[model samples]
Structure formats: C-alpha cells, structure tokens
Target: MPLLDPARWRLLHGGEAAAVEPATGEALGTFTLAAPSDVEEAALTAARAQRAWATAPYSERAAVLRRAGDLIRRHEPEIGEWIVRESGSIRGKADFEIRTASEECYEAAALAHRPLGQVLPSTAPRLSYTSRIPAGVVGVITPFNAPLVLAARSVAPALALGNAVVLKPDPRTAVCGGHALAAVFAEAGLPEGLLRVLPGGAETGRALVEDPRVRVVSFTGSTRAGRAVGELAARHLKRAHLELGGNSAFVVLEDADLDAAMSTAAWASFFHQGQVCMTAGRHLVHSSRYDEYVERLAAKADSLTVGDPYREQVHLGPVIDRGHLDRIDELVRGSAAAGVRIAAGGRYRDLFYRPTVLADAGPGSVGASPAYGREVFGPVAPVRAFDTLDEAVALAGDSGYGLALGIVTRDTARALDLADRVPAGLVHINDQTVNDEPIAPFGGLGDSGTGSRFGGEANLDAFTETRWTTVRATPAAYPF
Candidate 1:
C-alpha cells in the first residue's frame, strides 16, 4: 500500500545488510530499509574518521580516485541497473549517470597532481604564497536525478584535496550511490573513514550537515532543501555549497538549426522525465520561427515512449516516484488554471508522466508559474516565444532561479552577446542546457545555487579552501 515500504534502503557498511524486516517500514518486495536513526549512526562514525582521512597524501588520494574510477567502469552495467531500480531512472539514463561519474573521478585524478596552489615571486625577502587546502570533512547531499555522477562532483573534489567525505544521497536513490561510491573506494584501498556512504532521508542529511565534523556541505537539491542546508551550516559557521533549483531557459534564434535545436531541447527539457534541475525549464524562441519551433518541439515531446526504465526502446522514464509525478501535475494544472496554456502535456499515471511541453505562456501570469519558475521535475517543458533577443534575454532573467541557459544560433556575435546577458551559472551554445563539461564550471546565479559543481580548478575550489601563508618583511614588528 505504501509507495516506499517493503522495498527500502539498506545501510551499507553499517554492518552486513542481513535480512531483518524493519518494523512499520514500507518496501517494494522483501527488503526493508534501515531506519533514519540507524543511518545517522553510520554517518557519525564516518564523520569521526573523516578528520584524519582528510590529511591523506595527494598521491594516495589520486590512487583512490583512479581505483574508484576503475571499479565504476567494471561495474557499469550493474550500477546502471541499480540506478534504475533505486531512482526510477531508465537503464540508458542510469548508464549515463554512472558513466559521467566515472569521468568526474578521472578528471579529479588529473587534478590531484595538477598543482592547486601557486607561489608568486614576492618583492620582499619573505616567501609569501597562497595554497589551496582541503576544507576538512565534506558532506555531500546528492539528488536522484544523476546520483552517481552528481555524487562524484563533491566526492572526487574533496578526496582530491585531501578532504574526506560523507555522502548522503537522497533516500529514494541512495542504494546505487552508496554502492557505487564505496565500492570504488574499497577497490582503490581507501580506508573506511576516507569516504563513507550513508543512506537515509532528510534527517540523515540534516545530521551530517549539522555535525561539527562536517566543515563543508556541498548539496544538490530543491531550493527549500538548499535553504535548509544553508541554515544548518550557518548555525555552526560551516561552509555550505548549495546547488539548488533551476528554471533553465532554452533560447532559439531564427537562424538556429531546426533539427539540432528541437531535438536537443526535447531531450534537455524532458530528459529523465525532466527530473534534472538543469533541465530546460523555459524555452524562449524568436518570433520569426516561433510557431515552427514550437510545433517541432511539441511533436518531439509528444512522441517519446515511456513506461519501463529497463527497455532500450524507451528514452523517457518515470519521475523519481509518484509523489514527484503528483507535484508536476499540480504545477501544470495550476499554471493552466492561472490562464497559462498547457501547450503540450499535463498527464499523470501510476509512476509515469508522459513527456509534455507548454508554450506561448505569459511570463508574469502567476508571478513565476511553471513557465518562468517552479522546476517541474518531470516530463514537462514550457515554451515561451519571444520577438526580440532582448525579450528572450528578459524571459531568461524573468525567473528567480538561474541555474543554466541554452541558446541555439549560428551567429557567433549573437551567441556571445546572449551568453554575456544570460544570468545562469552555465551557458550552452547550440546544445542542450543540461550538459556539463568536466573542466568548465557549472553553477547557478540566483536561487539556483551558491557554489559551482564542475570545472577544472573551480571544482577543487568548492571542496578546498585557501590559507594565506606569508612571511612579513619585519618579523619582529607587530600590529599596534
């Protein structure tokens, strides 16, 4: 009867996950998850060990990352299937998650030896330099959209910088995350305390963030959750890296390629049932070809076959669960009622929301409706046609959230101009908004997030801190 009862999460490394039915818990079949309370203890133990682990040598950290990456590749298929079972993402999508995570690890390894700190030549006789250092034990709260890869964004960087990590994956998708991360560390010979995987709901995450041992919190979740993490971190004066909600914009100029932009927009907006925070939340098209673009996009959105995640033929998958489906439905219906047109989809069923698209909606219709705000984490993409580039740019900035923006056009000047004007953390030219490069920095500007996720040295920046080391010219002279 319950949505997440009998089929529950197993607290890995809390001990062996023996068959013991947790009382009053829900499950899909026979396995019941560990209570949130039990999960907290595991996190505490990891936190206890994180301190010393953060001091591990750079070579050692690099080895750990490389090994973890190897293990991820070795178990890619199993991990992919696990992602589908745990987070409701499709098999192909799951593979993408695992694959992308492996790349992060690989990138982190390269960064481990890439020289983080710099020592500039000082005019004085003192050796004054700045070196990037670890921020102690880090708490990574990853969502289900891209569990494995997103988890690595924090984990790899922290480990590379000699900071141990305690990853608190979203309860719905913690299984694959816990296993995928810990399994690699194990293969790489990282000690238990170096990287710990704990699975639970909000309480588990709260405990980790609020823990004194956790010096930094890198979280990826809803805006509300981001605020919660920020508040908890603030209480203890700990650093918080909040990658929150985003209502991304996809801008299409008249000269843009029809096939390329429409195809990418369809997948970018509704990919993973549109559960991605960076998914195209808004589609702003030029008036010259607005009608044609909307038609192609709507057709693309409508044609996606859904149902089973394991099916190869299915490019679309269910939202995380029925609860997410309900939320998407509510947002869509409310938008429709508020005089915003549901240009494409507002359908819901048992754990399935058909790929949907909404277009020609008013920007301020409901003070940031689904078209402008509210991340519809499902198969819903809203389109708003614009007559001028300025109108498109304004629409992009119309929302409170500005995580990512996608612009499709051939003119280099136009792309560059829009990229400068757009207020998103990430800007994609002639591609989907959801893509992330391992070397380029990814983050949001407003309610989208505070810190960044992917980049060459910036990823390291989020996990590590800078300690100014200076030798004064006059060592004996003190400030008055």
Candidate 2:
C-alpha cells in the first residue's frame, strides 16, 4: 500500500484539489483538502497520541528517526523523481533536498541523546534541577520551495523530542513535500496519529495556528505570511518559530577574487531558480570592479539553460507556476523602467524565467525600484556599486530583512569586520549567502522573523519547555 493512501487517515470534505506540474501544467494527482474541522480533529488526535509517544523509550524515538533517514536515502531516486516533477526542481537540487532531508532526520535522532536538563544550586536545603519537556502537539506550516528539507527539519526534531506534529504542507507540492515525508515516517514505524500531513492553503495554516491543542507552531514562508502567523500564535499564547523571507546581500570587495566570487554569486542568486529565502537579491561590489563583475555575471546568466527539469539536463526549472513567473517578470520589468540597465535576460518562455542581472542599479535609481530591497524570490540579481567598506555595510543593512549576508574578500580581517556590522542572523565571510546545515542554527532578524533559531541544540529550545523542580526531605515552616 502507498504511504499516502487516503485510507490511512480521514481527509474531511468531499472535494479534492489537484497537484499540478508547474512545468507541464499537468495534474500529477489529487488530494483531499482538510477543512478547519479536520484540523481541529487532527490536533486532538495528535494531542492524544503525544501522551504515549512522549513516554516511549528515547531509544525507540531515535530509532524511528534514524530509520526514516535510512529509508529516505534508500528511496532517493523515487523521491527525487517526485520532487522534480511536483516542485519543478532541477535534478541536482532534488538530490540536494533528498540528502539534506535525510540528514535532518539523522541529526534529529542525535537530539534524543542531548542533555535534557541541568542541576541548579538551591537557596534552601533541597535538590533543584531543570527538566526539558515536550510542548505537546506542534503545528508545522511549510512552503513549496525546498519543502522536503524544510518540513523534515521541524518534523524530525519535534518527533525526536517527543512532540507530535500536524504538518500543513503547501498544496502545490504536497506529493513530494507532505506525503513523501509522512510515508517515510510510517515506514520507519512511527506511531500513527503522532504525525499528520494535511496538505492545504492559508485557511489550513490559520486553522493549525489557532488550534488550541497545538502548543508550538513552526512556520517557513514569506515575511508577510510569517507576520500573520506570529500574531495569531501570540494571540493564542503559543510559541511560533518562523524562518521567513530575505533579500540577502552579497558583497564583493576590491581585493576579492572576481572569478570565484562571481561563481558563488551565481549559485547563491539563481540556485533553485532563486526561490530560496536566503537568495542573494542584492549584490554590492566595489566600484573598482563593479563593471567587470556585472559583465561577467551577465554572461554567466545567459549561458545557463532553463527548461522542464524532468525532461532535460538544465540549470533551472520552471518558476513554480504562472503566477510566480508573472511576479518575477514584473520585478524585472519594473526595475528596467526605473533605468536599471538590464545586463542580461529580461524575458521568459512559458513558465521558465531566464536568469537576469541588472547593472547601474546604484543607490539613487534601483533603490527606488520595487525590486531593490524587496524580497524578489526569483532568478534576478541586482548589482550595486560601493566605494568603501562603510558604504557597503550601509547598503547591505539598508533593507528591512536581515536573514543572511555574504562578504567575499582576501582580507579576512576586513571581511570579519564587515560581518560584525551587518544585522543579518547568518553571515559568511568567504562564501555566498544561500547556505544551510542540519547542525547549524538557522533564522533571521527584524522583519525576517522572531529570531527563534532552528536545528541542533536550538531544536531542543524550540520544541521543549524547561520545568524547574525541587525536592526536600522536610517541609519548610510557613508564615501562616
């Protein structure tokens, strides 16, 4: 039987939603949409199951996660196929997602063995200590871009920490992101009801956040949506872990290696068609090399191919759907209208938007364009010139987002100095902006999110609450 077999769980409502292939506009399959009532039921079910799952042996929980990781690795080809066809990911990106998702499970398994509490000194004649306890049921809302890895990072850790999860994956990539993840857990012997996959839209996400039984909400999406989720979660008095959007900056110093820097910039800006939250949307190069940098980057962008990844060996796939394609096109066109020279690529065919580079997007002109500091989640790189380190730092931190920042220079000391002044949560002195590791804490600052980092030791803090306890051999005298 398939892991996503409808018989496994009750998907309320008589209607179904289609999961269409973005590249071909063909229906890959259909899934029942969960109503608000169904979300309520899922939370209740997860809460009930969490009681037993929480008390289960830590070894058992760890085993389940480890097995899931193995299963994902074992079925990489099959799952990769689903990701490519459903999410419009290039084959290389699909492979990266599979590998990273599996690593998330493996790392989460290790989380089971981390120190759960600490002993503290007490003022009285008593033993005092703190214990980390699960936060009951957790609500996870994941976006379509890089869904598998994003979902796994939260789901695996929540489960490993003894909390049940009710996942709401983006409906568009449900098959690869939602069903595949749940299937791996089921095959790994995870207890039923401990994890629920409810592929849905905003209504479903809101329902999950508002559900009383869900104590913690893990969300990954746009900054606008993340703000709403944070507000709603706060109104409900629940903790929300939001890893939102970014218009990250990639700074190139006069002393940097243009060849290597440009390569990193291309990958950072155009990887996965730049759907990533950490995409290097702004490029600040020193005035000495600004023109050369733009020309070389434009040539690189033009050399890359965009097509249906499932049928061709291409650098990039479709831009998720027509709506997303239109949004990217609008950004490029709007910037061009504002006198931002289009160094290369300002067009698209079907759903494939070409990788574009904008030059002469200085502080005065492009800064006024909508695509300047805004999160243009597409394959568009806007380059600006900076004269000194101070100006570069100012330009990089000018945006409301402070998710990730990159600085490339041979002067390690200067690069480190620049990193100190940047407001971003994650910074790379010698590398590009788009980077993630299962063991590293990942998050952003300001409008980007609440700075509730995820992964490694941070997962324990995000998924569990600390309870202080004290024991005494005799009762203390009371003032009564």
Candidate 3:
C-alpha cells in the first residue's frame, strides 16, 4: 500500500506540493496546499461549527474523542509507518509519536465531562459563579517534527473544550499528520466542518492567525516563526498559545553514575536526530567527570546505527530536508573552526548527520559562535566542563531559551537547589532533557515561549475562557 492517499481526505485551496520521504528523498505524493483564502474559509466554518459544538452534551463530545483514540490505536502501525516516511522518524520514535498522540486523545476525552465551573461567595443577595467557555475558533499551527503528537496536543484539547479547530500542519508532513487527524475525527463521528486540516507554509499560518473569526491560536515551531505568530495574533487581539524552540541544558554532577549519565545523554541528544525542541543542546559536566564522560559519550555515538527508519536496529534517520541538513553541517563546521574539538561523529552522509559530540564548548565558545549559542536542531551535543555546582547552574541559565533542564545527581538537596535556581519551565532530576507527559504543564520560558503552557489542566485555560455570572434575588440599589 502507498504511504499516503491524498484523495482520501479533503483540501481547502492552493497548488500541489510534493511530500518527499526524507530518508531516501523519494516523492511520497503530491498534496494540495492551503491558500490564504482557504484559511479564511476554514476560520468561518470553524466559527459556525463551534457555536453548535460548544453547546453539545459533554457525554457526546467525550464519546467522539474516545472513538478517535481507539481508531488511532487500531491503526498505529500504518500511521507510524507513514510518519517514518513523511517525517523521517525511525521505527521506535515514529511508533512512540503515534502512541503518544493516541493517548493524548484519550486524556483529552476525560476533560470533556470534567468540572469546568467554580462557585464563589457573594457579599450581597446574589450568587456568583464562573464557568469555562470555549474560545471560539482555534487555529492550530504545528511543526513537522512530531507533527501528529503536537497537533493532538492542541487539537484534542480544543475539541474537548467545545472549540472548533482549523489545523495548519507543516507542509512537509501534512498527509500522515494533519490530514490523517482530520480523517480520524471524521470517522469518529465529529460533525462536518468542526475540524479542518489545511497543509501549507507561512502564508496559510499568517492568514489563520490574522483571521478575525479565529479567537485563539496554538502554534508549535521555531522561536522565530512563533514570534511572528504571536505578533500577528496580538495585532488581531487574539489569544495565542506558543510552544517555541528550546536549547535545554543537561547537567551531569560528580555524584552521577557515568554509565547511567552516558546512556541518558546519548538518547536525549541524538533521538529523532535531535530535531525535538527539548533535545539537550548543551551538556554541562562536572570537571571531576568531564573527560571520562566525553570519552564514553563519543563511543556511544559511534555505535549508533543510521540508515533506513524501517529497519529494526536503525537508531537514527535522516533530518526533515536538505536545507536543514546543510544548516546542521554548517554549524558543525563553524563550531569546529572556533577551537571546539569534535569528539565523535561529525560528518553527514546525505540527509543523515552522524551523532556529533563537541568538546570544550564552554561559555566562551557558545557565546562566540552561533553553532554553540543557538539551537542547533540536529544530532549534536556540546559538552562543557564546570568546576562548581553554582557554575553549572550559571551555565544552564545563560541561554535565552529555557524550555527544559536535566540534572543527574545522587544528592537530592543539591538537585533541588539547582532545579530551583534554573530558569527553565520543566526541570528533570536523574532524567534526560527530552521528556513530556499528557498531563504535565508543557511549555518554555523567555524566548522559548510566551509563558503559555499546554497539557494537563493547563490545556483548559489555553483553549477556553472564563465567564463570571451572578444571580440576584432582588434588584440592586444604584447610586443617584
């Protein structure tokens, strides 16, 4: 069977664009792009659907979401394979994404019937209460990396909250991610026009954000693109939930076990080719273990298998595209020239970049070179040595992006202290930097995001609005 059948779904507008398999540069299929007018139409349709969906019975909404989850699980193998072809994810990672996305649908389904109102005391002869209401039309813009999961992160919650959604997925992976999601919901008995999937680039996203009918915008992508979305949403007085980029810091303390740290570090830095936003960009090691840690990490990188994503033993796969591959290569070259020594794999064969580890990439090198300072968004780990716990904390807090931080230590007191001091939104102790759960508050700090989080109870706030109401037994006296 073909990886994707474009005719199985609907398209809004625009010309056709090819969906290329990153692993082999094969043209999976040509898909129709969503134009600006299509975005406008989707917003209008969402507004209409939202009016009815918002008043739907909680049971009805919950049932639909539950069905969607079941469908996703039942078709995980096919969807996972499509994800590998569309987004260049290896088998394990692709399956993980599909499973996570399916779980998100179930988690979100529970929220449908959950309590959404609060009763408050009133000073006068009146009863006061606040109820959560849908934020009208929700515009979701998701990135290619982990597209299915990210879309589910926003779409499921918004739908569960009774808000109709207009999803604009990255053009590169729209078939397996966005269009697939739309089809799943439709099959699950969701009303027509309630969820619209439009695959396109910046123009479609801009149109969705600027559309007056779209009351809320949920975006997950690069910090640069997120900033533009925020600005556009702000100008239109629309609510925006931004999950942007990250340059997470992985700290290895002296008390940490070398073998454990090395294993976690390898996965955190190289998984999904480090295309994940929460991938650890910097490894801050205690001077006591820096040398041995780097040596072990280098060996681990050399052992990883990089080839066909479908192969059971393949550990890594190609990046999203050639442009990104070129960018990763440039960063490695520039960093190498800045006196940063490559301790492990540093070369690229086609779209597959070998997992790379850089030594002596301390504050000086990071600040002096873009490759070290900015989010590399590739399978590269820059290890820096720090003498004191305070220095490690300082180094981790140096970046403008603060999505997540990892601390590997046996001392609970020291770990807690450092976690408190770190500016990141999510802090992990004895774990890798790349982590997420359906019920946790997922977002970042500073340029990493706009202080808005999605997941768990946070999704209720992001996808809904609170309205206060009061009931009076008698007419209130007014001042003359």
Candidates in order have lDDT scores of 0.73, 0.91, 0.89
TM-score of 2: 0.98
What range of 10 consecutive residues in model 1 has the weakest lDDT sum?
A: 16-25
lDDT tens digits, residue span 1-480, model 3 = 333357854455688888889888888778789999988888888899889999999999999999999988887877887899889998888878878888899999999988989999988788999999999999999999998999999999899999999999999999777988887898889999899999998888888899899999999999999999999898999889999999999999999998777889999899999999999999999999999999999999999988778654689999999999998988888888888899998898899899999988866645465566889999999999999988888899998998999999999789999999989999999999989899899999998998899998999999999999999988889996
Off by over 4 Å in 2: 1-10, 364-367
Q: Write the per-residue lDDT of candidate 1 for residues 1-480, one digit (tens) a residue.
A: 111222233433333232211111224222233355544565567666666666667787788888778878787766776677666676777777777788788888887776767887877678878888777778888887788888887888778777777787765665666545776676678777667667666767777877777788889889998988889899999988888988888888989889777788887887887888888888888888888887888788677787766544677766665566677788887777777666566775667777877766667755446544677777777777888888888888888887888888999688889889878788888888888767678788789887555567777778788887877657655588
Model 3: residues with Cα > 4 Å off, grouped in runs: 1-5, 8-10, 365-367
Measured by lDDT, the strongest candidate is: 2
| Model 2, residue 35: C-alpha shift (Å) | 0.7
- Clashing pairs counted in every model: 8, 0, 0
For residue 41, model 2's alpha carbon misses the true position, in angstroms, by: 0.9
Backbone clashes in model 3, listed as residue pairs: none
State the weakest 10-residue window (summed lDDT) of model 2.
1-10
Better of 1 and 3 by lDDT: 3
The local lDDT score (0 to 100) that residue 133 gets in candidate 3 is: 91
Clashes of 1: 8
Candidate 2 or 1, higher TM-score: 2
Model 3 / residue 174 / CA error / Å: 0.5
